[model samples]
Target: MTMTDSAPVAVTEAAAGPEPAGAARWVTTNDCRIVGRAFMAVSLVLGVGAAAVGVLTRVERLDPSAPDQILGGLNSWFQMWTLYRAAFVLLVVLPLFLGLAMAVVPGKLGADNLAFPRAAQASFWAWLIGSLIVVVSVFAGGGWGAMDGVTAAERDAMTLTLLGAGLVIVALLSGAVNLATTVISLRPAGMSLLQVPLFAWSMLVSAVVWLFTLPVAAANIVVVYADLRGRDPVAFGLPESPGIWGQLDWLVEQPAVYALAVPVLGIAGEIVPDRLGIRLDRRGAAASIIGLFGLLAVGGWSQDYFTAPADHRDELLYVGVGVAAVVVVLAFCGALADAARRGSVRLQEMPSSALAGSALAVVLLAGATFFGALRVIKPFELLERSTTTGVFNAVVAAALIGTAAGVWHWWPEILSRPPSESRGRLAVLLLLAGGVLLAASDVIAGFLGAGDRPFVGDYDSGAVGGLNAVAVAGSVLLVLGLIAAAAAVFETMRPDRPDGPGAGDAAAAGLLRGAGS
Candidate 1:
């Protein structure tokens, strides 16, 4: 057929928009940004909440006898459970959501919308419900026993089991949903796996890590729950074996932290080069990714040795090797940074939030590396018996501070607008002041050997006073950030009329006029 004959005649319909579909309106393929923004909002809240709670726990440790009822009653078990719960939410749940969002949102990704919107929605609801169940059960007061006093051995057993199982379910659902979406829907046409952005690569690796590690963590939680409930956990068959579960928990948690760190590292890799107006060293970036995954796999083996028997020198040696691997990973990070510092890589125009967040994450990773060295290289005798000391408190503080700062630095990008500067500045000041006061309390209390004292009536007056002040200061920071974040959201949604023709408007109009000619 001739070309003209092959071209079908077209009919033009009236240029009317579709009728409103009410609340049941289906999101089109072009709505990836909206889905991504929503996911990020929820993830940020969970992450920040976890960090704030962790910092408070650290402050409490600075002064064990502190009168300020931060989470109520200075009970060790209560504090332990709360901190563990918070850590799980932050490390596991938040990262899972972040991976899913990053997989779907960016323009480089082929996704027009979330790969499986229903699955994404289901994952969110499942995670929320599972988290709530775990939290509420803690306050139920029967299965877990009392907060002020020790629970009956029976109650302790039941409580741990319930919490662990709930967390496992949440982790499994999140990992599966994320992995499916990333593999099936995120890859764009003509883009090879090698060509994917560093962040997306990290997410891909993280999902695989989750697939392997989360099941192990879940198994460990189940066994621990059973042990707590006064049952013989080994009765569970095959995959649920208690001994294997313990080994896997250690394995999973070690790499899991790296999984969280890698994405932030990738974000740094991308942002720094762009901000400095130079091209990133693609080979260096790829090397960093490979080295990170290798280190994560090896570093994970060390957690098992933490509570292993003193005679297990072989286990200790294994841990040392893992530590060495981590050192290598740190070196890779240094290389990446050095490349940026040189003219080899430059960051083009990038958001301030990206710059801040990426910088803070790198700092946090550095701090983690320092502590890992201490824990690994120190004499086993000194490390094993040095529980509940000021030094230990310092390590915890470093981790908490690093994570919190990183989270805050990225808050604006995640929220899609600047948070109220007044509130952000106030939070920064309060965090600094609170950190100082808490550190001071630790010093004073240490001088009095408060660390050796029992949790009862032995009170370090100076420490108690200092901790109370720190708690108050930290609370202010938390409240202010929340208020500012809320205000930013409200302001963004408010309608406003357009001003006179600006650069963006003029450019658009010019394009339209040219098209007419």
Candidate 2:
């Protein structure tokens, strides 16, 4: 029999029945589920590792002399943040989402396997290794790419960043092609274009989006490498030039908070209907999200980058991207509301539902803050844009939690068995609380005349010091949330993990009862 009609059965076959003949010896295996889970595990670790660094940076701010003692002075602090950004932007989120694509899309599409399995494997390895190199290269480059007086090691750092990024692009391109092909060609007998899950559709669209955005980033990386090596300074432009803005505008995906927002919103679409026992009133929701993201990628009308405060406060004026992002979501919520009105809907802090809500809140708050900026503060009167550090922190934290949520949502299918419950609900709660506190404090401090990178300053006997203290508390909570998340993920990957379906059928059955209700 053809594979398309049997794709769903194929997924459970590895565990639900006796293995295929010589299944262990099958060398050309193109298992989408395994690759996806592998990608998810690796990306989650990278995310937690970066967050741990962020906690260190925040802790350093609590004590005035800590940077010098703990982080090796200001130059290294610069490198630390740079590495964190590189890891956060280039290393974790996209791959984590794509990993979900790898695992979930085929099953959703009723495909036997990805269209190009070898290529998908290549894509994963390239991204995994390249991201590792890209992050390490930030340290190797010694903060000199954006600084002066480059040394031999620093030059190597620049070269590695370019090489690693190039490889990542290669991986992305391969996966994009493979995924698009799977969705188009591999549907079961009766499935059509619109029948695919919104989650899978979003990933397919994001793959095409990658085709547009990442190559430009790769070119920028090459230009940067050439400049660091003294190849053509005038050709590449220097650190403080407008060209750097373009480079950052690309890397600024987190601070901008829209590119990955599409798939995440789609994730919410998938979760809500299942958990709430309602059919999604999904009219125009998927298409609108895709269109909004495209506009967002173009910097959203008059906006330059949404994530950073210091980068372009001088020239950026429009709230086009923010408004569109917000509207698409509000439209989505409106649809969800309609569904709830007609069908059963309940308030849920289930891991998936909570993640979707928290992520949407983070992005909405950011868009609102910028919209509020236009009304409250003039551009010239603005404090250092770096004071907007909280926006970046909250967005990163939310996205990380969303990635964790995807893992939880798909864990059963990806592993071909039932899953164990860990502290997922707690993890989601801690992250949401942390994000709100972080954003409020950072934005308030920025408005109150705090400069970027000011780890210590007096309160002037007012709320500034209090807000700073509150931000520190938020950072601590963020650390706790991440630790909780890491524990949940690691519990799944343990070779001796006790989460086997045989042991957990009762729990799984209970979960089914809950979702069905």
Candidate 3:
């Protein structure tokens, strides 16, 4: 547990020069900015694909009577359905934030680069390769849940998918560790943890949460993979059941689902005050709320699949955690509001998309927590219903909004250019509309008795079908928003731009100068 020094670092501002060009530059560069951009670029592209998959999955549910008509088979539909959920969180939202942290956290802390630069690079490549494996294997008859059954080749593909998942988790964990170490061991002189930028502080907390929780998920995959390969099939290895998805579904559920969104608080904290040209009020309390949020989001203990059908959501501790999250979010929002109130501002100035997006992210999160509280209420009986999907839609949409906000707020440090406010606004509005439509429809559908698992022949109501259509529309809007955001990011890297490939170094150098000032 010692920090070993390895690889070259641009420790001085003078080192902010142009980097190598072409394939070798991206493939072999040790710069944290380039490494981070690679992660963001790949993740955003995959996010669009994942969101598209989600749209298709929802469309499949439009006619639940036929179930497999759109996808051709129960197993195929199951693969796409589970793939949409898994990829959206794992391959898209989490990695997008990790990339942003990698690019921005070091500069915020006055550090020259990530504590372990080569490891960051390795983590990016490993994650990318593993993501490809997961996507390919799923299409090749391997996915988290098998609805009907599987052939021998498909079984082998399932093992590959598991391996890819484990690799992806480990890669994300490695990146998180790098960020945590950079924050802890590389702070500038006279700066305490309390004085660190809110976003950096949030990343530290998120890193700890990821370390505590993600390994358990990795362990889940390991056990399931072992059972699948064993001579005798037990509970997890049965190829005909959806047990594997059940065991892993907790990651996308309540307390665990919130883990991927911890950075949303950080992004909001950093952006709101910065936009208002004022320091945050109750900074310490703000940090504490963030920490508490992250703490509640550590859901390694919330898995209930191994036990006999006893739902963990019914537990008092789980219900309390879900309900308390709303208060934490409200407290942070109040702090931001106080800061904004103390600022000398004009209404004509209006809010920037970054500011609006940050605020919207918090709102979406609060709405999600409200739904979570309702779902845990025994009388509501919303457990294992589409309410779970509502929570996920809201949470992931919040994360995406936060991602756009961060990019707009820190375009200089991340994208090496000024962000286009109009494009940013368009993206945020689309995401907001999409999030509301998707989440609200799902919640309403759940209240109408829509089962969590689709295509089991229970959903024949016209109201549910209309809600499903709305969700699909929301998914379409989400995809468009993501595309717009991605385009805005890539525009900064135009071939004619001076800061295209090696621009991140210069950006980092500028951030260091600003921090020193």
Candidate 4:
């Protein structure tokens, strides 16, 4: 019998099974969908907290003269700065994408589930616990760096932070392995890697990049943790300064930062073609462009934590990669545009949150790469300026936009219902606006001579203060946007129907039935 003939029974039986109760349900479940939803939900909550912290940090920047008033002290201010970056990347955007991938990629690959379902569950819980520890440690006077001298208690907190960060990284890596294995090993008969859907291909590429890059970060955390626990702190775990941030900030900066946006390209690739109801023009070229973009984003060699900045950042290779990234993004955008040009240009039918979000994500990524390329020019002197923060903001915005698009597009599999189109569009607009403002203001402030350091907000330009104020406004918008998006997402999550039939059920069952056909 065809898989469809059997789906009702399969879904009914699946739904009728006794459900696990309380903590056991969440902790022991091997369902990728549940695990994925958990990742996305937690990331949204953390995103809001990070945005609020961002607002507070920028508010302090409004009056560089009174830096400590808002956050209470320079140490606290620095803590918020590093904490914001760490939390946003680790606890928010990366997990957001990874979670969605966990839910979506296996089905895309025609697999019944992830190759390592239990590992996916373990990864999520470990990531969640580690994320909490990271946040609590930061608020408890332990963060990536301490501007002032640290007390014994604070030192111990820093150690905890390292451990949490390590766990988070390892969890992410494990999740990546799950995704990569599913993609590589589970495609149906006659479907080569090239024949996979764009989203799946993009995920496979992203998984490889993460495997190559995040381990370096995990290694950095390990080294820092060991040094912090040693008799004497070394160059990395220096007592009372920005040393910790210096060693780890590379994750959120150029080349490496683009790693987070790899899936943005994939999301756009999937959305545009699907929304247009037409095949993408030059599909092979599109796939090649995505792969090239991923290649450029591999940033393991770009970290200069232990070496002089010039030794790595000033090298031809660094500059070439920085500049090449912009071209690669533009190429993918061109491919997308070509597809749209060939397809029927229906305006009313278009403009769904998914399409808008995808378009905005590509634009934001392009802007980010442009800024990154500009920073490589020694004359711009923007490498150590707030322009770095601009690049950071834009890249993150792209990821956020992409994920929003994915959420809307995959709502049936993800949230088990169609998203409110109006609400999704509103969230996309708010997020895009906030992201643009934050990135542009930072870039302009850097040109106006604002340093990269958050505490050094006293740039001579009064305009810099004005820009900081604008960033504060942007942060507020980000918080509101996140709330709107979260409400739209979580409100539809049926608490009582934990095992409702999902969009994936039929596809999963079909794959099982036709495995050897």
Candidate 5:
């Protein structure tokens, strides 16, 4: 008999001897994998939308004087805000849901269902509602991606507060679910923390980070909302004050970047070893974890420099630089190189996911180095002339590209079928070409030029010209590649029936029999 045919018989045989009264309970775990898949699908859509907005922003800056065509009079400033808001929702909200569901699901966690299944259901519903509220806030009578005109300032204020609170609750739920599942459900009799998969470990670390950071973010949002309504939120203090609340606001904002990136970093680490077919090195993994935590702490402290006294600011800058160089830069690079080498040595066949994730990791690491330098050595220089704008753009581009590549690498396994080889080749070509164009643009814009007074101009001239061209081209390529790959995967994974009794009917009957047994 074929494997599909035998699968039904095996399930039926297992079910024929069941005895426990509640053993056959049709629990919420009925569709964990499907739920996980749907979560990932939504995440991809949001990610692509956010990236598209970013590309447009770059294009608008490249040639500001051009007729307001793209995005309907969408200037760079407005696009920046849109990108920021979109990114916050995509990066913060979507990932939280995906990560939580993945953690609590049956196979990953080995749970019959989520620890608090009702809470799990509630979490998903609450997150959906909260996400809609935040997204609607963007388009509530304002222009596309506009936020300034929502007339319900009080309502908007309340919604924002509710949204943040909801996010915190979601984060807490993720932490609880992941922790309980990892400790109680996912761990087989022999599995220990060290034996757990790297991806699971990464999820665990990210959960801890969320546990600590989300409350701060939620509290600050509440305080900000209160202050907006002419209420005295002196408990949190003003931005310049010395109170813990002020410190908390600064604390929440700084680590927010890492809060998003760390999970991605963990995913990269896990994928690299698996794709390469190498055993993950425990020491290297531990070092990477430590480095991530150290950087998170230092980065959190550095946000105070924005309003801090000169001496305190200087000290924080030095600390930040040290952490970046010693902890984040050197440590992560070392771990990545070690993992890559091990994988290359062990695995004869390298999948696209492995290659793409490795490359993207390098790009992000490089961007992080640049960001560190910008923040520490010449903060005033970049801020005064807006020279840092290019750096910011570069960082965002690298991040989005890296994220896309990582997602593509894992798409086949996640979707249960390989994407079309033709589309895969096209994606590779588009990404390479786009990278080349963006590089050329950077060089032409005099990014490396040495001058006391930088000549930053409008999008009509200089680097903006080249940047715009590259941005538009890259965006088109990226969207096309993503859509093609998604279509191919969906097509390939569609159900196929054999010339015999349908598998679903057989499987369903077998399951019922097993339950009755």
Candidate 6:
């Protein structure tokens, strides 16, 4: 296939800016790898901090604890919980995914540099500065739970914080355009649409979604910012409406948020073939699934709309909703299953395979649970009751798997070396185990009540204290897993580390060898 000519890029910095002098290169450099690494580094630091706070929040839920002493009283407790989630979604989830894309997508398109390297850098800085502002705001108790108390200063800070969020999305918007243009215009010889890497294809689709939905997100943020500024409540949609694409989770069930999981599905698709050293079982089918996912993503946003499930079902919304859910869940699961079945998949030196395998398991289980719920109750109620958090956590786990595994799989290609294999595997397993335990606890909570990651008072922990304890343990394990994963990756990037495995690495390897294949 011949490549088509794309319109001229603006190239704003190509000849316009003063060159950086001396040590500023490392920080201000537009090299995709450097920028990507910076993004992940900031995310890692914040994720570790969030984990500590999150564990404390979860621990507070244990029975017989003094309410005042639960993570430094109620205010701080709420702050910690709010910050924990913000860090997870905005910092950890987003930056990690963006970093991987910036680092990997260029090579996927057979290009030497991103189409807008400087724009990628801008995306990094904008997101960083904006994220920092929001982090400050949330930590200052400018979050959802902070509304009960009215302080002029706090409210103003939160308004800035929401604007910061809008700015962050704007930065991401720039990245989406940069990446999409790069992939579209820079493919190497004979590369056509179907011939592109699954990750690259998924990123393109995700970028397109961002283009349409981000403006809506920004408008919603504007309305919220207006409300915070004491303007009339610009209630754009009813509280019962589905979240706008991925960001809308509060009002309706959160399958929309799982839209982020589509690219993750593509990442896993790429990993399976590389690990197995074979061709993908159904390349066209996988591509078709991705397209189906994209359509379902936007179309299914308000599956139940402003009304109840029964009303939607009467309008035939139930069938469409079911189809969308099944596509999102079954499409990727089926692809992975097909690959594994056709290939001699095994645990090799890299444990990322294990991580990807675990991811597929959780996604399948989560999807099956939804289908089972469909038989007994309305899909909306099923998700609203308790299954939402459990399923969301599982899908998040799968996304984590996709991100970590993609990094691990492409590390040698990108970094020209391998990381601590044994340590990485341990981290992957810990995360998977943590995800399973946490999902189970959420399922138990579903029998108790409904909401997304509510704190001590959100649900009746008195009746389900044991289940809550399991969840606490799960949180601890999950955080430790993230710490381990971060350490392995960062250790590889250190300046003077030896190429070979160390004593701890050797011992871990031997332990694994002795345990089994």
All-Cα superposition RMSD per candidate? 7.9, 5.7, 4.9, 4.7, 8.6, 7.1
Winner by lDDT between candidate 4 and candidate 3: 3
Candidate 4 lands at a TM-score of 0.92
Score every model by TM-score. Answer: 0.65, 0.79, 0.93, 0.92, 0.67, 0.80
Higher-scoring candidate on TM-score, 5 or 6: 6
TM-score of 1: 0.65
- Which residue segments of model 5 deviate by more than 4 Å? 1-31, 63-80, 83-114, 141-185, 189-191, 229-255, 282-314, 317-330, 339-351, 383-413, 421-461, 472-478, 481-517
lDDT of 4 by residue, 294-387 (tens): 8988887888878874559988899999999999999999988987888766776647798889988998999999999998877887888999
- Clashes by residue pair, model 6: 243-248
Which of the predicted structures, 3 or 5, would earn the higher lDDT when compared with the native? 3
Q: Write the per-residue lDDT of candidate 6 for residues 1-517, one digit (tens) a residue.
A: 9885653453655555776755596567877877777777777777777777767877876743453465555555655655665566666666777788888888778797789999899888898898888788866746543413435665566677677778887887888798788778887878887778988888888778656666665766776676666643244321121121223333123434455565776777777766656778778788877766655454334434335444443334545554556655576677677777787756564445434544554374445336424522544445444455565556556566666676666664334235666766777777777767777776666767634445433556565677778878888887887888788878765433355543234345335433432
lDDT values, one for every candidate = 0.44, 0.60, 0.87, 0.86, 0.46, 0.63
lDDT of 1 by residue, 241-358 (tens): 1232234334322334444454445555555555455666664555455436534543333445336664332355745643654565566567557656774332463334334445
Clashes (backbone N, CA, C under 3 Å), per candidate, total 14, 4, 0, 0, 5, 1
Cα error, candidate 3, residue 87 (Å): 0.5
- Runs of candidate 4 with Cα error greater than 4 angstroms are 1-17, 21-23, 348-350, 495-517
**Between which residue pairs do clashes occur in model 3?**
none
Kindly report which residue stretches of model 3 are placed more than 4 angstroms away from their true locations once superposed. Answer: 1-19, 495-517
TM-score of 6: 0.80
RMSD of candidate 1 to the true fold?
7.9
In model 4, which range of ten residues has the least summed lDDT?
508-517
lDDT of model 6 at position 423 = 69
